[model samples]
Target: MFWFVDGEKSEYSGGRTAVEIKSWCTEMTGPAVKEISSRKLAEEQAGTKPICVYEGPEASTDFEEIAARKRTEFTFYHVAVDTEKPTVSVQHKSEEPVACDDLTFDGLKKCLDDNTLPLFGVLDGETYEKYMTSGKGLVWACLEMESSDDLEKVADEYRPLIKEVAEEFKDQFAFLYIDTIQFKRFLEGVLGVTELPTLAVNKKAGDKLKYLYTGEMTAPKVDEFLKNVLDGSIEPTLKSEPVPSSQDEPIHVVVGSTLVEDVFQPDKDVLFEVYAPWCGHCKRLAPEYEKVAKKVAEAGLDDMVVLSKMDGTANDSPVESISWEGFPSLFYVKAGETEPIKYDGPREAEGMWEWIEEHHSNSEGLKERVAAGKAVHEEEDSEADKGEEL
Candidate 1:
């Protein structure tokens, strides 16, 4: 029977009911029974759509509201308090887990190219696209520590637990690993992961739903946490807070870490700058960046193309997510793509403006901007030539 304890500590409530929900769940799904505390926690697990039992004191009324809000996707069993043999009304629903495999980023791409499905394993930078863009799923990604002994120790400790849990629930989840030394940019720069040997899950619904494991690193603790995750007992911690919205500036100031949603999801063509405030180069380019923003706005491509900046040096702004080679580095994001397109062009206002026009999807508007810009340049040239002739 499933126990629904009220306090933080989990405790069993009463005896087995006439129709036990846990037994029924085990029988139907083969050992997938989980004990949960509240309806709110259950709803968080709705993504995975597990069989959730709410036996809290308020189980009677709570499950009904949750089932309705969840749109009848998950199977719910509510335990009764009044009777020794509590009757459970099972609401059945069909659900499937997101399929993933263990491969490096490039290997993942090759699998995609070859149209093959992979079993979960350690991943590299190239394979980031496979998991991040899938739109929904769980990726239990771990950052490997450096020292050989420490690395071996973590491997020795986690390998068994990962192997055991992943084998049991392989169909329902994807497990991935990364060497912090190799794919330094992928996690630290892209995901804002500061803690070494950290495990984070991408819920894939939104950036807000991506959570990192902040608990102790023991195998049992980790196992419990993963179980909690699988059973929907935990909510995802945000990778970065919501980038505050404002309409005041021509350049969209990326005040926080909503890069995946604000930049990637909508898939607007973007010329984004990652800069350190202390860097002289970033300071020098700041004025020109704003000018480029204004020039793009003037061309009426602000909606289609965005010019934005993030302070890579800020405490909240993860240096990992920005992962720049220098103080100020620019990346262009194309519409409908998850991977960033690196910008190697000149950083001047006119040069940046021309690049935006070159990539802009509005062909006619691009032509108009090009012609107008050329006309002004030609006029300046003609005047200069006249003065030289005189």
Candidate 2:
């Protein structure tokens, strides 16, 4: 169950938007629980009504059991709906331009302290793992160096520009700096950083990890890249290891982790199987999945619909997406469509073809599938809202 306060229209009109409660979850679930609890209490005492306890589909059944152990275990949020406009006091404060903080060891450490956005700082191994490795949505890490005064000057020169961009994307993305001198191995080994002032955008689409941007960083160039990433115009670099090649099989091997290259860009309907090695169900479904792949190729849907598979066990970052429902999961990615539709029909090759023929060919059905895929993400966000309490 997730708890948050939301504004609605008189119970007559509908309203749905999750806000401020996001910050509360971090404080309540984090290390400083006592401090956060006291603060939360103070806020409530100030007459801020707490409302809405939403129960999601994936919420734990053992809510009472968990609540027994931890008093903060939120079962439901009080629903706060306000239709009337209330008068409020206006307090004026000095307005100033947002500033960017320079990257340092201490500043980088502090990045992990909370979920604050536009947190631009140097990223070391510690910061990288906490913010980048398992990072959700768009996380930007711009690499810099202190080896040369000129290089430092270049970084300093772009600080304001970065700050401007960060401020605009503060709500959706996280921007950080990485000093190559401090974390040389991580820069080279993990991120494959070669150029100075390379602005790299780390993103995960579905279960696939991809870098949206990694190149030269000028104000205009970086701005264009940022725009492209936001609008889904830029191609994403995969974060997973290379897919093992298979010569004899009819199945097309997904060479890298880039969903854009293998899944989205291609003009074909994709039947993707996300399976774990250890799962018995996955093992049982492998041969059938292969059959579906071979049959699809034979049916001449190979160009229109390609069959693909990814080892969920082998790849972590890509599969860590909110799109990953479970192991042995199958999805239908229609050609030219950005969203992949979950395959809930029979697993047999014939059933697969029928499903592809019926929904993939029908434009309206495809739209519903897209809408359904979007709903899944919304659910995931709600679950994330409840995660802190658990």
Model 2: what TM-score?
0.39
Q: Estimate each model's TM-score.
A: 0.39, 0.39
Best candidate (score: lDDT)? 1
For model 1, residues 268-374, the per-residue Cα lDDT tens digits are 68778878768998889989889988876775666668888777554233223444546687888777766677787877888877777676556566668658877
Candidate 1: stretches off by over 4 Å: 1-211, 216-218, 224-242, 255-257, 265-268, 314-325, 369-390
Error of 1 at 13 (Å): 59
Specify the poorest-scoring 10-residue window by lDDT in model 2: 86-95
TM-score between model 1 and native:
0.39
Model 2 agreement with the true structure over 48-109: per-residue lDDT tens digits: 11111212222222322222222232112212224242111111011121211322324322
